[model samples]
Target: SVPGPASKSIITGAINFPFPTLRLTLAQENLSQFHDLDDWGFQQELEENYGRVVKLTGFSGYIDRHLFVFDPVALHHILVKDQDVYEEMPKFLCLDLLVFGEESSLPWGTIIANIAKTMMPAFSTLNLRGVVPLFYEVAERLDFNSISCRTSLELIGRTGIGYSFDPMLPGQEQTDRYARALRGLFVTAFKLQLFIPLLPILMNYCPRRCMAQEGGKLDGSEEGKDIMSLLVKGNATADAGMHLADDELVACLSMILFAATDTTSSSMNRMIHLLALNPEVQHKLREEVLTAPEHLDYDKIDALPYLDGFVREILRLYPPVPVMFREAMSDITLPLSTPIIGSDGTIMHTIAVPKGTSIYVGLAAANHDKSIWGEDALEFKPDRWTKGKADSVETKLPGIYGNTMTFLGGGRSCIGFKFAQLEMKVVVCVLLRSFSFSKPDSGIRWRKTGIMPSPYVNDEPKLPIVVERLRA
Candidate 1:
């Protein structure tokens, strides 16, 4: 058996599955460290203390053991080579079905394949280049505080679906119900973590409908530019065998809208905060963006080396979703890139995992691994890429973006990653050139809420930064 920390309680395992009151009390005291595995220091401790493949006790005592793995070779096998054997956990699918509907499950079926094919054109460089001005238009109106969330939502709405959630004009309130709902969805889901097992049952009793408005009939002749419109157009022309049903189309829309927003906003928030903290890095990046041609297209924006490195470094160190979960479909042995000494003092190269065992893919841990990224892995250094440090790291790990696990890998990897990158680059470039950001008066702390983490000040979910308009 894989070695890990012993459970303090037979009932709760390694986790503190306390009652609501007790949990609240612990949280109030800031002593609920064990409750959140996504804590950066805790993640590092797991890798440093127990090695890459630490067995963790899950709910329901010894019978429920989970493997917290970040081994590069093991990650390759799980996320790429043998993905079918390590499918998304059932609870995750159930949650998606409850939140977005049954058709939201995009990991399987020819419908997904068709959807990916249809949406490819919309995410292409040519298409994104057309949307760069819109990105700048939104960014120009944004102030440092309370803008990332709304800015990202509006950007996706305009570029992804030809809609506008907010005009983003000064002093205008975001009153779109759908946009507000999308913003609060993850936070609402995070509060319901304890009730995930009952989601399917609750969904049966009270079915949740997709919030996306029904797409009007589309003929192939309609030259709509947005992603959803393109999908609708494609579906209209598709053969009978490949046509997507109405529910499926709605599900796809909701899933795309939801998937594209929060993670991108979180990443953008991290970038801004990091830039504020590192003024020199910010100044250097600003210079790179300022020196570039006034007309910044997708190619020009993507070509900026310092901007690219800055984004990569932020994603590498502080991934929006730090950990992802998968479940073993059958008993299997996982190969490790580096052998670890077992509890019995014997070096083990592979681990035997049973069917139904849960696995936590340690994304942040892998990114911070000293062996792969050298001893300075924990430091925030974008120059690593420009200095050729990324060359060696790229060949060792199987990541879809930047050779880091920020966007994951293989078939189930983020489909709109390119779209996201373009959005971040365009927004950051526009913001950095127009304004300067400095740390806020209050101390900022990042707290993990469900799958994604957000910055907070004095227990409120907020990122306060001092912003000054730059002289033209």
Candidate 2:
């Protein structure tokens, strides 16, 4: 944002600053193997690169801050001890500038904060309570071949538009189109899934795998009336008004649909694969889920401690958003219990963080820390989340997540986590009740995406899941 090239000045007197002298090279390196940050064994990389307790510094940015990649102790200092000093980049302008035009840019941090504050109510216990039945429909459809690709099409349509998108009654097709557009809009917002949002019309650049297409009446032609219709009307719900403008309104709603389906589908894929591989853990989780009272309501689902812990453990072992990005504001030196290094050959005994740095906090790595989580960090152990001895340390890692950084920490944690939890629980319950499943063979690997990790089943073993009915 500051004009000209960002200055990369080095400090002559380093010890007086917050960072102790840490080697710069220790932090920055060529990501030669070139997979993804999440797909690669980033925890192992961080551990080997910085020890369990070293600080890493590569890029410097807009503040007196540099990137601080440290263990939990040092991370606690920045996220908690020095909370105000760090925040999400107000706009994440670099991406906007690099990709979309300036008009496409948003004051994203403000938008994100607003989303959390306003939308969180929908994810509260009351609203989250309603998501279970909604999720049950997904599993049912999956089994019965009733679900077309756009599953959330029905859910957000009713919730957002105040009616079902089905138009056999009247104005049904129009409503459905709007709902479908929003769903597609959100799923493809990120750079990875650029199929729908950016590629307004399918051109040559579209990826072969991303060839999934839908025929709509037209995008943005809302004559038939939907949420966009009501949004066009003077009367929108207060929940809808949480957005700053109409564009914000559309984007946020799209985000909701995106959050709903993608997290569920991807996460379920991983959990299902894990269940197949570790039949024992799956049985344990299923047993816990089934133990819930006959009437499956919010309280009953929430009461199942093992189910909750098992889901938390799944998130811990495999966090959806592996890397989070933040930008520095000013020359604010953070107190790190450990040491860090900056890429400009600056030895940070205590890091004298330069401004304008984009900090990538490793969520998956932090979740799997051997030091804090003990040695079995890599294994999927729900007991650690529930019965294990982790009370004292749990409170300290409050980035607004349950116990670990599954949802992240700070004001910018996931607003939809409660809803996500509810969705996961309900689906897990229904699937477990319907069938006892396992991997057809060994050597299946679940690869990671930014949010939706890919479950590469080892053998095309028909996924030969044996299904049986459960009595009501």
Candidate 3:
């Protein structure tokens, strides 16, 4: 007998076109066993019952066949080996275009690669050191629960484009036109559920909530000698086809602001929450940070073993973006590390994914796969790093950092991953040195929307932590 459900099962060996489709009505016996609600839950359930790879069918009437992959070998194959065969889904890109315009995302792959290559040096550790004091200044006024969003804004402002947006600075009010517009834009765009295909048309008709036109003339304080300014200045000197249009420049600025703020903040919120829940770990981390050299530089921070492990563990356990969506550009066979019994009673070494199939790369699931990480896979143990954690896993998971699927891998990996890591390390070091964090109460919980996951209390996006100031 095959591994899948028996009622609508087909035999193996004779390759079928669409493979066996799991009906949603019978989802309880099939898909529901894995996950019916959220991405994290789905990945956990899938790995528990179906092992590495599972074929899902009948997804909200659009998709016919979708593959939920949790195996590290399969992830490596999909993300690294045959990446060209798969690309970002249209929905994600459409949302990007609606929000940031054609310049930043319309031709996402090539443009992003080019932009990242061009701007990589600006965000590198060497050039970013000058902003350390700015972080210290920001950390002095940090509100543990709400600091993530504001601190991230300041970091990106001072470093990314040489501007300052933190309310503490003179003429840098949070209610400033640009800041106000950006905040209003997020609230409005999210309200529209911008991922829907009709958003472009809807936004076009609804001028009040349209983010694409919200900037309204990027003159005065909004324009500066920052990254966007350089891009605009450089574009002015370049040939027509070689440069960005005015709208494109505005979108680039918006994209930078939108992408950096929430993700870094969300991560900060979660990491501190983890530290608070485990008081022993928090004390150990604080001691490490405080005992480090009086002047902590990029190299010194990077050298902290425990801190590195702690951050990596946080990303592994609770990646802000849990699942990555991809569409098969062509029919292809995905190589699997472990073979699975097909629904037809045949031993299958590879998965035959047809063209146009939606594939959800299970990031969190692969991070916690028992086969890769051993029995205590789901537990958050920072010590896992010291004990040959990477070596213990026979199969290599394709990711930019810590041999985990946190930052993803391949051509479309997170371009700002290094910047994000540095920003996080600096903030954690500063905050831990001055204060301690712990859970506010027993009722706090983490939840995920369609996009990213964040913490909540009483059904509101709030992370109230117990904080204590450390004295010299």
Residue 452 lDDT in candidate 1: 77
TM-scores for all candidates? 0.89, 0.67, 0.79
Query: On residues 374-433, what C-alpha lDDT tens digit does candidate 1 reach at each position?
Result: 889899998888632374564477888877888888766777887887888888887887
Error of 2 at 428 (Å): 0.8
Our tally of clashes for model 2 stands at: 29
Give the Å shift of residue 36 in candidate 1.
Answer: 2.4
Error of 3 at 215 (Å): 16
Q: Give the TM-score of candidate 1.
A: 0.89
> Relative to the true structure, how large is the alpha-carbon lDDT of every model?
0.74, 0.50, 0.65
Looking at candidate 2, what is the lDDT of residue 16? 19
lDDT (10s digit) by residue, model 2, range 117-206: 655554556555655565555445442111222344454444433334443232223345444544343324444332323343332221
Off by over 4 Å in 3: 1-40, 59-63, 103-107, 143-145, 168-251, 386-391
Ranking by lDDT: 1, 3, 2
Cα lDDT tens digits, model 3, 26-113, are 3343344333223345556667887678776433323456677877777887887777677778756666665555323334666655
lDDT of 1: 0.74
For model 2, state the Cα shift of residue 462 in Å: 12
